[model samples]
Target chain A: MSDWAQLKQALISGDGEELCRRVRQTLDQGVSAKDILNQALIPAMDVVGERMENEDMFIPEVLMAAKAMSAAVEILKPLLAADDLSAAGKVVIGTVKGDLHDIGKNLVAMMMESAGFEVKDLGVDVAPETFVAAARDNGAQLVCLSALLTTTMPMMKETVAALESSGLRDKVKVMVGGAPVTRAFAASINADGYAPDAGSAAKLAKSLVQ
Target chain B: MKSKGRRGGIYRPLTQDQVETIHDAALTILERVGFTYESGLDDLLEMLEGSGARVDREKARIAFPRSLVEAQTAKAPNRVILYGRSEDSHLDLQDDLVHLGTGGAAIKIVDPENGTARPSTLKDVYDLARLVDKLDNIHFYLRPCIPTDIPEAAYDVNVFYACFKGTRKHVMAGVNNEKSFHDVLELAALLADGMDALKARPFFSIITSFAISPLKFCTQSTRIMREANRHGIPVALSCAPMAGSTSPITMAGTLAQIHAEQLAGITVCQLTQPGAPVLYGGIPGMANLKTMGYLGGAVECGMMNAAIHQMAAHVGVPNYNSAGLSDAKIPDAQAGWEKALTIVLAAMGGSNYVHHAAGMLESMLAVAYEQFVIDDEIIGMSCKVLEGIPVDADRLALEVIESVGPGGNFMTSPHTMAHLHDEYFEGNGITDRKSRPKWEKDGAADAWARARRLVERLLSGEETPYISESLDRQIRERFEILL
Candidate 1:
């Protein structure tokens, strides 16, 4: 098979090791790293994303495909031109303070990464100050906050408030989620967008950035 | 399922080993992961300690031994009866009985008058109950819409009163708080003629979400469940664990976590009042990973709840499960398909009380009058399916078949005349069974348009409600009677 076919085939199979190997071989063949990523790797996850939206794919499979994309992206990161490095916008994500849940947040981070965005997961029980600092440090264009508990849902408001107070609210789009978070709740907290799960979160991140 | 067409149903998606695997995992989860009690639940923590479960007081986490959970679970009743105002409407819930009904606290209603959506009021609640009373297939009334306009203090009484006055079919609602729970109990006593009488023949039951998802207890709802238990009122322990969000991503994993939560909630109820009549409610919703909506429309949702019914049956308790709630915003083809798919699964699986079977739309955010009528027709059709094919000499119709042998027409046969009404699917709403030319002659009405007409017809002055004029007046004089 052609090396490009090998890259696409590796992506579909979610073979992280093979995806990285294919990226390396393609680079060795004198192909541009940007072309390998944008043509083979990035578009591969987009297929996974579309399949998921179409219910043709599921969570574990998407996660596996994301793992493959991440493996290939790591190989292309150093060699890619700077413009291709920021091909997808940067996002800062975390579970809000007083909420320790991370599964959903981590899925969002992985989905964002797989969707070609640069993601910095701030981990669980993240305070408002930490979010503002991470967004500043990472130059993130989108901030994603998650909370599993209704009591901790209020912390999302505080985090959004922190951004406003830090004068960075205008510079970035904010998204809120968790089991208890609703579209009405997100709007009430002055959030830029709300997605029910990780795939939509990635879609929202892309829409917000564009 | 002693009814006419009870098939000894064996829809086993999970084998004995798989069920055991889930059961063992649940016990391990309780032992290791434990549950976090919401604040102000020190009494619950104390209860756990007394039961020999480990309690981390400061962190509000409690872990239980498998034996303690099993013993408490074993104390729950195997059979429960929910009475209608009239004796015929009563529900005798067992592992095999399937009761289809409507359930939601929908804040909005698509107005039947003008087909516009608006905030629901106490009258909407009362009217919906009246319509439920009229529908032959909708088995129970669970206050499909929330009376959002009522005052907080009087909401419980008024809501209960509206439902009671509208239909005698068993009404179920969750008390807003412990105090309102007592208030509604008092109102129930008045309707039953006394507190003891109400306890003796409780027509109403409480559906309480005593536990939060991922094995934690919500303090306030737990308190209400306690009050309902102590008062000898039957209750349903409803735990809605959203898959891929609150619970595990795998549907099987979600069921395991759900089984653990349901068992724990049942344990609490039994601990409070031994042999308390409680239904094990495991409404495992899907967090449609794409939308993050707590959806109950998928066929897998039907399978999960059916499996939940089986799990609760395993624990020897009547199961209260949800189905027929569509993610569709309107009563389109999507609504019909989603509702039918889920309700049939629950029914075939033998869930005792399968709710959200009517009127629920937009992922339980809103209800519609036309949708209720359409769902009533769906329920009628699905009930026929649940009545699995009967095998009897008479049903086999040897004589009739012999008489009509060799393609002789059964159209004029006596057996056809006798059995046709009961045997066939007699859909009432706009299912569009008519041919195109005839349908055009009859105005070419869609399901929505036909449903609206049925709603209007059912709400007409001809049908008398279960509540008597004199009794309603007496109750009104006693309570606020906001409606």
Candidate 2:
């Protein structure tokens, strides 16, 4: 098989080391960085995501494939142009203030990154100002807020207000999620979208940006 | 509600010969493979050693001989009555009598007010019990959620107190430790007027998950089981082994392994106190191979749980099995279908003491209040199915049918009026049966929305405690009552 096929196989199988090695091998075989990425890594993750949606693949496997995809992209970063790196648009994400839950937030971030968005994850207990500033600095088109506690759900509304006051609300879409946040709550907070889980979060983020 | 402890066993998934084969295989497993105990349970090991079991002290393994297993199994009472607070609510488990209720130690609940998943608190425990008390179709109240708001030391007493405060149904829960177990017994004694009175009725029972899967015993839960047995409290030996991860991959193999585990627990319980009231608790489910998560809503899980009822019957013990689980995040169509299929199968297969029959979602990780209301309707229908058509001379309505023969209407017949409430199963109004115009005029609410409204209506006007004020105050003085 071709070198790109080998790289795709390794990435889908979650063999990160073999994936990176095959990336180098494909580069040595006179392949352009853009061709290797668009032809192999991106398509491999698309398959992984589809498999996940179809229940053929699960969260751990999808995360492993996402990790491998990032590692392969890292090797091709220097060779590719700046705009080509984030072809799917940039995003700012965080777990809102007073909420120390980041496992769900991290999963959504990884899924979004694998979906080709450049995600700047502002970890747990992030203030609304931090979210606004990160969105502005990253020139992001989307911001995803997560809160796992009922008490901290107000921070999601605060983050939305901060984005509106910062004059970035019209420029970017605000999506809220976590265990306690609902679609009606998202609408009540005047956010753009809400997704129940990580897989749907990535899909919703893509649609919101579009 | 109309038919409590209805005779089921109409839908047998396994043949008599197949059940005997599984039983024989389980006996062989106990005789050869045996079980390993944790290091600190040497006293339990010594007890087993004295009861004609070969003990490998070096490996902490106690292998039961076939004769010892048979003798111990025979010592357990076949018909165990889990007494409710009132005589009317007692659950009689014998001869394929089925009782379905709630069970889980879920950490999260879909908040009833806002429809968001949140950490389940002590109030949720009490509130859910109140719901169970009002819903006639849900027969008993197993402690559904853990009180995440309390300290670990206060968990057992507070949870039991919250359950007792909310409902008069037979309450069952797992204790945190031996001290808490004793504390709860004292608290029950206080409520029942005396220790002898409490022991005589046993308004509460203990669920001891003594056996780990694949022939291993959990140390703390085993100690709790021994104490419960000695105290003459009914205990369920809960052994949940996932098909692929914990036990064998095939259904029969999983059943064999779980059966062996149950036999081991029964042997220990009978050895501790002869003729102890024990349940053959077998919660066997297949693993989601991709994620290795417990697949609680799988139809195969329903099949295995149904088959476990037959296995328990073969061993002459009332079983504590599971059904009515849904993996759906909300009370949607997926949740409805998954829960209905499994619950009906278990009920038809005659699973006594069926828990997780209501208020569970996301494979027992979380529960939705609306789901409980919805599942009550489903379980009522299952019990109706279990009641099965009673065809006799007068019930066949031969003369009445001949009188109303070809072109007559029996809508206003005396026979119709006499059998109206008894014959047909009128659901608890959660299900909609209206024209499009009528449904639209009523806001076109789905099952979830309707169930939500029902839940709101039930919990809104309730502040009555099940226990008396004097007893509550006395118990409060004696223990740290968080509720």
In order, what DockQ does each candidate have?
0.19, 0.25
Task: List pairs with backbone clashes in candidate 2.
Answer: none
Q: In model 2 chain B, where is the ten-residue run with the lowest total lDDT? A: B286-295
Report the alpha-carbon TM-score of model 2 versus the true structure.
Answer: 0.75
Q: Against the unseen true structure, what C-alpha lDDT does each candidate score? A: 0.85, 0.89
What does the lDDT come to for candidate 1? 0.85
Model 2's chain A TM-score stands at: 0.90
Off by over 4 Å in 2: A1-55, A58-210
lDDT of 2 by residue, A1-210 (tens): 377678889999999999999899889888899888888887787777667656688666777888888888899999998877678889999999998888779978988887778889999999999999999999999999999887899989999999999999999999888876899999999999998777778787877887
Q: How would you encode candidate 1's per-residue C-alpha lDDT over B1-483 as one tens digit per residue?
A: 112123313565677788888888888898898898768887777777898899987777888899999999999999999988886688888867778898988888988778777889999898898888888788899998888887767888899998988888899998889888887888888778888888998999999998889888988899999888998889999999889978987888999999999888988898888998999988988886655567879889888988887788888999888999898888888998999998877778888888899999989889998888888888777778766577788889999889899868788998888887777777665577788999899898888988888888888857465666777788788778888
lDDT of 2 by residue, B1-483 (tens): 465698889889899899989999999999888899877788887788887899998877788999999999999899999999987899999878999999999889998778889999999999999988988889999998999998878999999999999999999999978898999999999988899999998999999999889799999999999999999999999999988778998999999999999999999999999999999999988777554567899998889888999999888999999999888888889999999999999998899999999999988889988899999999999999987778998799999999898999999889999898888899889989999999999999999999999999998985777888988889899998888
- Fold similarity of candidate 1's chain A to the true chain A, as a TM-score: 0.90
Interface RMSD of each: 3.1, 2.7
Q: Residue B366 deviation, candidate 2, in Å?
A: 1.1
Candidate with top DockQ is 2
Q: Judge candidate 1 at residue B208 and give its lDDT.
A: 95
Give the residue spans of candidate 1 off by over 4 A: A1-13, A26-57, A71-210, B1-39, B54-63, B106-123, B147-158, B242-257, B284-295, B300-304, B327-329, B362-366, B384-438, B462-483
Q: Could you report the Cα RMSD, in angstroms, for every candidate shown?
A: 5.2, 8.5
- Name the top lDDT candidate: 2
